[model samples]
Target: MDTGLVGDRRWQEKIFTGEWRDGGGGVLPVIEPATGAELGVAGKAAPDDVARSVARADEAQAAWAAAPFSERAGVLRRAAELWTEHSAEVRTWLVREAGSVRRKAMRELGGTVAECWEAAALPSHPLGEVLPSERATLSMTRRTPVGVVGVIAPFNLPLKLAFRSVAPALALGNAVVLKPDPRTPVSGGVALARVFEEAGLPPGVLHVLPGGADVGAALVVQPAVRAVSFTGSSRAGHAVAELCARHSTRVHLELGGNSALIVMPDADLDRAVAAASYGAFYHQGQGCIVVGRHLVHDSVYDTYAQMLAEKAAGLTVGNPAEQDVALGPLIDAHQRDSVDALVTGSVEAGAKPLTGGTYQGLFYRPTVLADTGPGAPAYDAEVFGPVASVTRFSTADEAVELASDSPYGLALSILTADVTAGLEMAAAIPTGLAHINDQTIADDAHAPFGGLGESGNASRFGGPAANIEAYTDTRWITVHSAIPSY
Candidate 1:
């Protein structure tokens, strides 16, 4: 992957079957944060444009609903195959647009494409069950697709986020209207659209419009859209939730998180250092589930803190296109400043920077800090950059309380050599997903993935139950004998 400007004028000539030109003519410039160089431009969609996409999706959904489930699954499988073929190119695009480092971008591209293939196989086994009847004739239950789904993807891992809704929705025969983040829209829209085209999907089944907040607002409020699946910040998630409330549409939010990670006294100090480094630096800590708050047991606090600081210092922070670079720039300058403010505020509140509290361009130094009370901003805030705040807990109960104390319960990790201690802490934490002996970053597509409480809007985790549930709805069927008519 080479860090360079992305995008060509050809997108103007491109359309996903029936997708129209962006109505507002709002064009967002894609810039390389590191160099301040122009990458290219993407068309932004407004309220009317969102409505247009939704209308088209509604039209397609009717016909798609009638398509064989196997046929829908086959299309998704083929898209996954195409994704694999273009995996290298897609990684390059991600590094340029999403500011992902070469190695990390490759991993993201691979896993996200696999998510689609996994989603495709679901329809081959549409959920169904039977109930034996003694007095009644018969009873059965099955699943049905919802109407059109509105998906709003975030700037980081743009395609991966969009695919979350696109893969499952199409597999269950629902059309989608995707509103990708303005900063990084080209590859997600172009790549996925091409795959759908090659898969021989019909017109209007998949529509994509790119824009800022206004575009997102339009997509969620459309009357024809049955649901919304959003991935972004908490404040933005709230707005989407409110918009959907107007139309009574179901909304699935994978929103903001300030996750907690607890390291016990007996844990492997080196393993702890590596996990913390990856947790904070991977994607520059932009992911909602990354472990941003680290609580170490008092005994090993010094040893672990020293190791973490050294490791963070050793990380390479530069252009994401460089294969050796371990850390990439934050999405933009505004984001870099936001993380800076959080770190500065923490220091003002009486925290010590064990190492790393600097920035160069958009790249934040992998920062580690020793902090004070649990009420500190560093403890609970979503510091979406390569920054981690470390603190000490006296006991297992204290660690659990500190970890669960946050308002956001997106994800968590507990490190300990004692089996009983780790399990107890895991059981006590308030997060949606808790990891033992590992970082919170690892999640299987087949397992449920989501945050709890403020991190998400009423949607459940993604797994066998959740995946089929997301793409379909329960329907009951009953039968009665004519003998009863007598």
Candidate 2:
């Protein structure tokens, strides 16, 4: 097997259709975010490529869907094994192309394998239920595939995010057309094509296209695409939803989040501090479920903020390819500038910068802000960086109001020794996921995962239940032994 690294002879033409070929569009340079260097280039997909890919997928889907369940399950099971076998090469792509630290890269690799394993089980799950029928007939309902599925994934956590949708859609007998972000095409797109190709997925069942919004828009509106799965910013999600709606197509969205982590007066102080640190700084806070607000009870607000500040200051930030560090560089200068502007604006608007509020190049230091009042930039929006904003709440109602104030409601975490009280307060806030005595950043391959309100339209992915709902349509079937007099 070719390693597909920078110097690999096979890398120049990385697009896969059972064999490598130069894609429809020209070429796109893949850059290393940590250091300003071109790692390699990936083939880009043009408009004609989008049309041809979808046509081929439609042709392959019928035969693939007709295959035995055991055969379909076997493909995904093999993919899980292949992912682990190539972890070393995959990690290099992650660290250099996607700017992930070694630990974060390993975490993604492991999670991706778990996703494949979970998807492998989908083929054997019960399709539907038997329902009662009127007068002299036996009635039943069974799930059927929605034909071709279109997926658009972001740069952050590329492999895990893309495969979470791709694997299940394929397992349920639906073909997929995936559009990974152009910036991190190697890890996000080409590598996935090779993994599936090696796993013996039939040709044209999966199409990996690396391009920008133009390619994504084409996929969403394509007449042959019956459903679409999108994961990105809330703004982009809205655009995709509108396009799908115009075409009468089904869409599953996992969008942006400004989640909250609340600490009660009686909470374990050390535990609360640790949760906040990990929740806000893990992956440099680039996740949709990363904690955007820290609501601390007035009794413990001062002490908790002080402890968090100390922890932030102690964290190391540098290029992950160079040293062992807690945080790595942002995806690029645009991301770094956005994070810096939010912190700077909040500080000028009366929020106190307790620790780090600056950056040098792409590496922004872990920052903690105190007194982040309402309407402050970091307080009200999703700051996708290593920044934690702490606010004081006097009572339980005050805490609930503060947590529920954002337009985004992806996740919420409440911490207190009184479990009953924490659960009660968490119930008041409308969020897709609520955690007691835990942080906001969490995922399971066997659980329904998504958001609510502006975060998403309540469409979820993961687990057998959600996968069936997302990729299949239920149809009624009635059996009559003989026709009676009308």
Highest lDDT among the candidates is held by which one? 2
**Span of 10 residues, lowest total lDDT, candidate 2:** 1-10
Tell me the tens digit of each residue's lDDT in model 2 across 1-486: 245433354645455544567778788898888898988778888777788889999999999999999999999999999888888888888888888888999999889999999999999999988898777888889999999999999999999999999999999999999999988887888878878887889999999888889899999999999999999999999999999999999999999999999999999999899989999998899999998899999999999999999999999998888898888889989998999999999998999999998888888899999999698999988899999999999999999999988889899999999999999998999999999999998888998898998899774787998999999999998888898787
lDDT of 1 at 10: 47
Worst 10 residues of 1 by lDDT: 1-10
Error of 1 at 435 (Å): 0.9
Q: RMSD, each candidate, Å?
A: 2.5, 1.5
| Residue pairs in clash, model 2 | none
TM-score of each: 0.94, 0.97
Query: lDDT value for candidate 1?
Result: 0.78
- How far residue 184's Cα lies from its native spot in candidate 1, in Å, is 0.8
lDDT of 2: 0.90
Backbone-clash count (model 1) = 3
Q: What tens-digit string does per-residue lDDT give for candidate 1 at 269-317? A: 9888898788877889888888788888899988888898899889988
